[model samples]
Target: MSFQPLIHMFSITVESNTPLTPLDNVNDIAIEFLTHIGYLSKGYTPRSDAEDTSNSIPYVLFMDCFMKHPHKAWTADELAYELKTTKATVYRHINKLKSLDLLEEASAEQSDGKIKKGYKIRFGDLRKAWSFVEANVQMAMQNYRKTVEHFCDLMANDNTD
Candidate 1:
């Protein structure tokens, strides 16, 4: 099997903005936060053309299933059933979160006593999960910094006159 990076791919947008005060509604905050982090498309247009993203499968899977029950490990099948979508759709969303290092793999015992792979919010807390993401960003930056320094050294040592 090819060695897959722990994070297959990671992308985030950083922008300066005034800190937001907590909204009276959590879903409102969740939508804004998810969009800012690039997990949800900023220009999301659902198939039904519904104005509310809260009803979208990806949003519901993240907000309703994962955020609402942070401590519970969710299997893709369970999420697909809950969201009434296919397992592929559920995995697509889950993989996005995984790329962000915001989820932790877990084992859940099925009703038949078989253990299945599951995923949950890292450390069962969003704040803790974000810290993990931050660490990853820092490490990636450090690697880039090293490469830049090495390239500079190579250029400086070139003796061609």
Candidate 2:
């Protein structure tokens, strides 16, 4: 599927006398980078949509926990405690992430005669994912520029003044 840019149309105010801080610039750049890379659009809510009380909580919580210990594979019980949910819920979320190819089962072993499964974050393959995101961001930015130019031209032609 083609990627769509997530333009953040928010404004930030800063003192004119103060020099631009690295944090400020980095924030702007990160916003733009995330927008162009489609990361920001993943959780967007439609204007006319009703609230979705779906199974998003478990997935989000699982992601948060996974990020904290990307190298370690968490069992259903471990994830449940961290996420404040049930083991079954954690299992459901893990399955969902696995379906998305965001997480993968690293191994399965017998522990005390009981089978234990391990998982790892697949996107931690930073080199490859970063390269892919960079390319996608460039494409999205080009599209955004063209769109902005078209809108500006349209506004200029409109004699609303």
Candidate 3:
């Protein structure tokens, strides 16, 4: 079996931007912010077949289920029910958040005495969760730097024309 780290591979766009005054509406910020962080698909356009595709499932999953109740540990079943989607769909979005290292697995005991696994924002806070993403990005950059340096060393030592 192959070993998989708790943190999965994720891509985030890094760009310098001037700080802007906060928007009054959360959705305005959420859509753009989520897209920027690689949570929502960039340049997303509504499908012709769907009338209200602008409110995408992933967006709802993030805003309604997670952000609205950051402190609550949500099970896949609960998310599916809340979003009126299937467990498979819920898991897909959950995995996306997990890949970003923004969600943490939490275990909760049901009234039936069974422990159920759930997902919540890391430490029930987005700010704390973002620190993990920053650390991962830093480590990845360091690794890339090492590779570039090694390649330069290899070229310097190569005597064969």
Candidate 4:
């Protein structure tokens, strides 16, 4: 994996003067990066005739919840309660993050001592989880390169035959 993510992170800011740290600017930074990676849209407004909630709200809220409570494993129910959203909404966002390989399943101890299945940022570290994703992407690219090279070699040999 390259250091581009680190570089990308360093390059992000909440605004011209707001320092990006202490969870204050992290959500905006996360949103920016998510947009840059195609996981989110920059901004949108539904037509006046339509009644669609901005999908970006759930994504931003879910990410901000994590940034605020970084180590807290969360069930969809908990997220729904905290975000004042629905379980289905929470799960939709959770699934999206999961698809990015950013979240990991875990067991959280409930108030009554029952262990509930939940999720958290992988290893409780966003940067570390991002590195894991970058590694997977790098490996996949290498495999694709090998396949293309082999395909080209086969085509060259077939032409001679």
The per-model lDDT (C-alpha) reads: 0.84, 0.53, 0.80, 0.66
Candidate 4 ranges with C-alpha deviation above 4 Å: 1-27, 42-56, 159-161
Per-residue CA lDDT of candidate 2, range 1-161, in tens? 99796753322121223223445564444434333333333454423232431223443443356655676666776667765667776676566555434566765354566657767666555344345434555665798799999999999899988
**What lDDT score goes with residue 148 in model 2?**
100
lDDT tens digits by residue: candidate 3, 48-133: 23344337778888887788899888888888888778899889889889988899999856678888999999999999999999
Weakest ten-residue segment in model 4 by summed lDDT: 6-15
Q: Give the per-residue lDDT of model 1 (tens digit) for 1-161.
A: 89675644766665565555657778888888788878888888665444678898878888888889999989989998998878998898898998888888998789999999999999999999999889878888898899899999999998987
> Model 1: how far is 35 from its true place, Å?
1.1
Q: Each model's TM-score? A: 0.83, 0.40, 0.82, 0.68
- Quality of model 4 by C-alpha lDDT: 0.66
Best by lDDT: 1
Superposing all C-alpha atoms, what RMSD in Å does each candidate have to the true structure?
3.5, 11.5, 3.7, 9.1
Cα deviation at 46, candidate 1, in Å, is 2.2
Q: List the residue pairs that clash in candidate 2.
A: none
Sort by lDDT, top down from the best:
1, 3, 4, 2
Measured on C-alpha atoms, candidate 3 has an lDDT of 0.80
